[model samples]
Target: MKAIQYRKFGGPEVLEYVGLPDPEPRAGEVLIETTAIGVNFPDVRERMGVYNRAETQVGGVTLPQVGGLQVVGRVLNAGTEAHDHLVGRKVMALMSKGAYAQRAVARADMLVELEDDTDDVVMASVPCQGVTAFLALQVCTVLRPGESVLVHGAAGGVGNLAVQIAKVLGAATVIGTASSDTRRAFVLSRGADHAIAYDSPHWPESVLSITNGKGVDVILETVGGDVFDENFACLGMLGRCVVIGSTRGPGKPLAPRQLMAKAQTLTGVYLPSFFQRPDLIQRGLRFLKDGIGQGLIRPRVAATLPLSRAADAHAMLERREAQGVIVLDPRY
Candidate 1:
């Protein structure tokens, strides 16, 4: 099998594309012939040795391990928990590791069935970003009809999905922030009612202007750091701010006094932890499937690179050159 493996923790250059022995199906796991791989930020973090502060294996540093997190493929075999129905079924999985390869072994329970008509790339985009967006707006907060939403980094993978799903969840006005005119336009085309440039210093005021001086009801904040203060400023009285990611790095410490003064809520969302709550996962998966089935959740695959070009994909993401989800096809 062909896989992109990193022998050392460093930049994109460390990710080497080479041949490797096929991974075997472990007990309670399924061996998948990967069709599509979702290139995510965590992959970059893992490659750069920032995912978890753990000791690395000497030399090869787990040579067979790959960096991708999500994959869409056909299940070839299951090692345990016999389910004849799963064999050869088209499915999408959220694997903990090893997705940047022609074959991936994922826990059977982590894989979800896909409709025949569902594009592999689209399903590949769903598991990680989809789950987070869905949980933040609907499952966790329960966005009400006529409520307003603002999604930071709204043109990126999770942000774009948040923009589209906010409307489906009954948000009356959806505002999204992107870095450029092209990205702002893309966010608006994805169903957001308002689009603001993230680089503009007064973007928060612009949100206020669009909302008629009242702030938005909900805010999906992924870009943290200096801009986090502005995000809190844009939250309406009695509004909810969901912190999803801190791509801009850690922001200033939260002040409890501010929340108390405005009677607002600040919530932190991590999808991996949400898995322990099966109810949330079940409801979220249903919402994801329905959204994809209804054409409400469209995929923005700006580029599909081969597994060998994994380094280029990382460079594109780190440089902020890609508009939407950058995917990798192992078959490519």
Candidate 2:
């Protein structure tokens, strides 16, 4: 088997494509021949060792790690008879590690079977970013029907999907904030009612104007730093703001009293924590699958490179060069 791994944390240059012995599954797990692997921002952060310094119990990857969260593949075998039924079936799986390879093992219960016609590269982009977007809206904050939503980093992998998923989940008006005209346009194409440039200092005013001064009812905030602070300027009474990620790094501290003024709520979402609740994980996967199946949500694949170019994929993500998700085709 061939895999990309990092023996030491650093830049994309640290990722090495090398040969390895085939991985075998343990009880309740299945071996999968990966067709496509999803490249995410966290993979970049992992390579840089950002998670290692985090004070929270989130996202620390060990040295010499394969460092990927999801893959779309076909089952090759199973460890136990209980999971034998999965053999030879196509699946989209979420894992804690080891997905950046030609083959990987995933918990049998963590996979969702897919049809032969399903696009592997696109589905490969779903498990991490798609589920985060879904949970930010549907679980973290419980976006109500007819409510307005403001999504930061609206052109990003998770952000783009969040824009579409908000509409599918019944948002009356979905407002997206991106850094450029091209990205803002892309956000609108994904079903956002309005697209504003978060790069502008007055962007919060634009959000207020869009809502006729009432402000949006929900906010999905991924870009941290000043953008996170600015979200409060347009958060409506009783609105919910769910922090999904901090791509720009953590924002300044907030006073709890600030939320008291509008009776608003603030929440944070870490996808790994939800893994403990298989029921919720399955629910999120089903929602994403159904949304795609019904044509309500579309997961975009910006580019597909051979697995050997995994370092290039990481570089693309680090530069924020991909408007949508990039995938790695291990078969190449």
Candidate 3:
């Protein structure tokens, strides 16, 4: 089997494509012949040793590690007969790591069976980012119907989906924030009712204006630092803000008392934690699958690269060159 590995922490250059023994499925697991592998920002952060502080192995610092969280593939073999019915079935599997390979082993229950005609690349874009977006709005903070939402990094993989998911969840108005006009336009195209430039100091004023000065009912804060701080300005009474990521870096410490005035709520969402709760995982997957089937949610695949060009994939993500998800074709 061929896989991408990084023996040291650094840049995209650290990713190496090399041959390795084919992985075998263990109990409660299945072997998948990968068609498309999803490349996420966490994979880049994992490669840089940013997650090294964690005690658990979330794409570990262990040398020669394979870094990835999701893939779309076909089941080649099941470890046990209890799951034999899945053989030869197409699936989108989410795992903690080892997805950047030709053949990967994933927990049997973690795989979502897909329709035969489902596009592998498009499906590959869903498992990680899609689930995160769904969980952020649906579970992390229950978004009430007819409420308004503000999504930061609206052109990003998770951000793009958050915009659509917010609408699907019955948001009366979905406002998206992006760095450039082009990205803001893209966000508007994804069903956001409004798009504003996050880089602008007056962005909160734009949000307030769009909401008719009432402010938004929900906020998805992915870009931390100043953006996170500015979110409070437009957060409405009893608003719920979910922290999904801090791509720009962590923000200044907050005073818990700030929430006292508006009765606002703050929550954090980490996708990996949901893996332990199969019930929640199934709920999220069902929502995404149904939404896509009904033409309510669309998966955006920005580009696809071959396994050999994994480094280029990482570089594209690091530079934010892709507007949507980037997938790796291991068969290449």
Candidate 4:
């Protein structure tokens, strides 16, 4: 089997496509023949040694790692203790590591059966971004029907999905922030009531205008730095803001008194924490499946690269040139 591995993290050039022994399932695990591998922003962050997570650390050192989290493939075999229900099934799963390869092992509990018509590319894309969006709406924030919501970085993988989920969850209006006219148009087409460019100095004012000065009831914030600073001013009284990622920059000062004044809630979400809660994953999968079935939520594959070109995929993601999800075809 061939896999992309990096002994020391630095940049895309650190990634090396090399041959590796086939993975075998251990007790209570299943082996999957990888078909599609999802390329996420975290993958790039992990490679650069900047992603914050416990799994990103090992033996007090985080180097020498294989970076990939989500995969869509067919079950090739199962361990003795694995449930008999999974053999030879088409499934998608979140792997602890080692998904950018021809074969990988995963805990049976993390695997979800895929419908025959479900695209492998979309399945690979959904586990991380879709689950994040779904959990943000359903768990982190208590959103009410007829309330407005705002999504930052709305043209990207998670942001795009967040906009649609906000709509499906009964948000009266969804405003998405993008960087360009093209991305703004893309966001509007996908369900955002209005799409504004984050680069504009008056973006927050635009968001307020869209909500008729009441401001948004919820905010899905993926971009931090100045964008976060601006959006914080536009959150309604008692509003909830969920911070999932900070793609822009890390350091930003906040006025705690302002949050207290409005009784706003600022929360952060990490997918691994939710992994321990299978019920959340199940609910998210149900929503994703139903949305796809009903033509309400569509996961876009921005680009597909062969497994050997994993380096190029990382390069695209790092440069922010890729929109939606970028998939790796292991068969290639």
Candidate 5:
């Protein structure tokens, strides 16, 4: 089998497309002939040696690592027990590592069966970003109908999905933040009632005016740093803020005293930790399936590049130049 392997942690240059022996499934795992690999922020962090949740508890990553985070493929074989029924089935799998290859092993329980009509590349984007966006609005905050919403970085993968989900949940006013005019338009097209530039000096003020000085009822914040500070300030009384990611750097301190004054709720959403709950994972999958079937949510594949171009994909993502969700086609 051929895959991209990284011997050391650094830039995209560390990734080398090379040949490797196909790995067999362990107990409760399935070996998949890869269809598509979902490219995500964690994959980039792993390549830079900065994503090490396992380092403190388990151990640092092993060398010559394969770094894709989500895998969509057909089950070639299932190891042990009831999993045998999974053979020959198409699946969307969530993995911690080793998906940037033609063949990868996936935990049997972590996968959801895909319908024959499902677009393999699109479903490939669902496990990671799709689920994160779904839970962020519905589960994390429990956004209510007639409530207002403010989504930061609303033109990116999770942001785009969050915009749609907010609308589906009946958010009365959905305001999205992007860095440029093109992205702002993209956000509005996806269902945001309004789109503003996050870089604007008075976005929070803008939101206040949009909501008729009442402020918003819920906020979706993924970008950190001062952006978090500004967005948190926009929350209405008794409003909630869901922190998804801090790619910009840890935002301003969350002072309880500050929260007490506004009666606002501050919460964080991390997919890896949340995925540990089997109930939540399965529920999220059901929501995704129903959403796609109803035409309520459609994961976009912004760019489809072959696995050999994984390095280029990483670079484009790092530069924030890619639109929608970027995926890797291993068969290419």
Candidate 6:
């Protein structure tokens, strides 16, 4: 099997296209012949040795690692005790690692069957970003119809999905922030009521104007750093802000007095913890599937690359040159 592996963490230059032995399914796992793999921001972080998570000894301090989190593939083998019914099904799975390969072993419990109508590109985009957006909208905040919402980084993978989810969840108005006019147009096309350039000097005021000075009821914040301060300033009284990612790196000052005065709520959400509540994950999956089936939410895939060019894919994402989801075709 061909795979992209990084022996040491640094930059995209560290990624190497090489051959690897085929992986086998364990007792509670299934072996998937990968069709597409989703490239994400975390993959870059992990490759740069900046991913802040507990480390496990694999090969050594500089262990060779496969990069990827979500994969759309066909099930070649299923575990005896877990997912025998999944044999020969087209599905998507969330892997801990090693998805940037021709084959991957994933826990059967984590796999979701793709509808026959679902395209391979859509299947590839759904697992990580789809689940994150669904869970964030359905569980992280108390969403109400007729309430205004704002989405930061609204042109990116999870951001684009979040925009559509907010609309489907009955938000009265949806505002999204992007950095360029092209991205702003793309965000509005995806159902955002308003798209503002976060890079603009008047962005905070623009959000305020859209709400008629009332501020937004819910905020889905993807970019951290200075954007956090702006989000806080744009929040409505008693507003809820959910922080899903810190793509801009974390360093921010908060106004505690302002928060107290407005009776605001600030919450940080990590999707992995949502899995601890299986019902939430199940509900999210159902919502995503239903939305896709009904055309209430659309999966936007900006580009597809051959698996061997996984390094270039990462570079594209890190450079913010790609929009929506970028997928890798392992069969290529």
Number of clashes in every candidate structure?
Answer: 0, 0, 0, 0, 0, 0
After best superposition, candidate 4 residue 138: deviation in angstroms?
Answer: 1.0
The superposed Cα distance between candidate 1 and the true structure at residue 133, in angstroms, equals: 1.2
The C-alpha stretches of model 2 lying farther than 4 A from their native spots are 54-59
Query: Clashes in model 6: which pairs?
Result: none
In model 2, where is the ten-residue run with the lowest total lDDT? 54-63
The TM-score of predicted model 6 comes to 0.91
TM-score of each: 0.91, 0.96, 0.95, 0.92, 0.93, 0.91
Q: Please, what are the lDDT tens digits per residue for candidate 6 over residues 1-332?
A: 99999998888999999999988788878999988898888788778876544552122224688878888888898767468788889887886788999999887767778875678777677777888887777777768888998999898888899899888989999999988899899999999999998878678889899999999999988878878777877899999999988668665666677679889998867866765565666567667777887999998887999998888999998888887778999977
Candidate 6: lDDT over CA atoms? 0.83
Which should have the higher TM-score, number 2 or number 6?
Answer: 2
lDDT of 4 by residue, 1-332 (tens): 99999988688999999888888888878989989999887788777766545654422225566678889888888887446678888888886677888898887877788887778887787778898898898899877888899999899888999999988889999999988899999999888989998889888888888888888999998888888888777999889999988778754777677798889998878887876887778678777877876888988888999999999999888787887788999988
Winner of 2 and 3 under TM-score: 2
Residue pairs with backbone overlap in model 2: none
lDDT per residue (tens digit) for residues 1-332 in model 2 = 99998999999899999999999999989999999999888888778998898674566777889889899999999999998999999999998889999999998877789999998887898889888888898888888789999999888888989999889888999999988898888999999999998879799999999999999999988888998898999999999999887778887998899999999999998988988876777778888877898899988888999999999999988787887888999976
The order of the candidates by TM-score, greatest first, is 2, 3, 5, 4, 1, 6
Give the Å shift of residue 11 in candidate 6.
2.1
lDDT of model 2, residue 14: 92
Candidate lDDT scores, in order, read: 0.83, 0.89, 0.90, 0.84, 0.85, 0.83
Model 2 residue 188 distance off true place after TM-score fit, in angstroms: 0.6
- The runs of at least 3 residues in candidate 4 whose Cα sits more than 4 Å from the true structure, single-residue gaps closed, are 52-63
**CA shift at 146, candidate 1, in angstroms?**
1.9
Model 6 scores worst on lDDT over the 10 consecutive residues at 52-61
Give lDDT for model 5.
0.85
- Which should have the higher TM-score, number 1 or number 5? 5
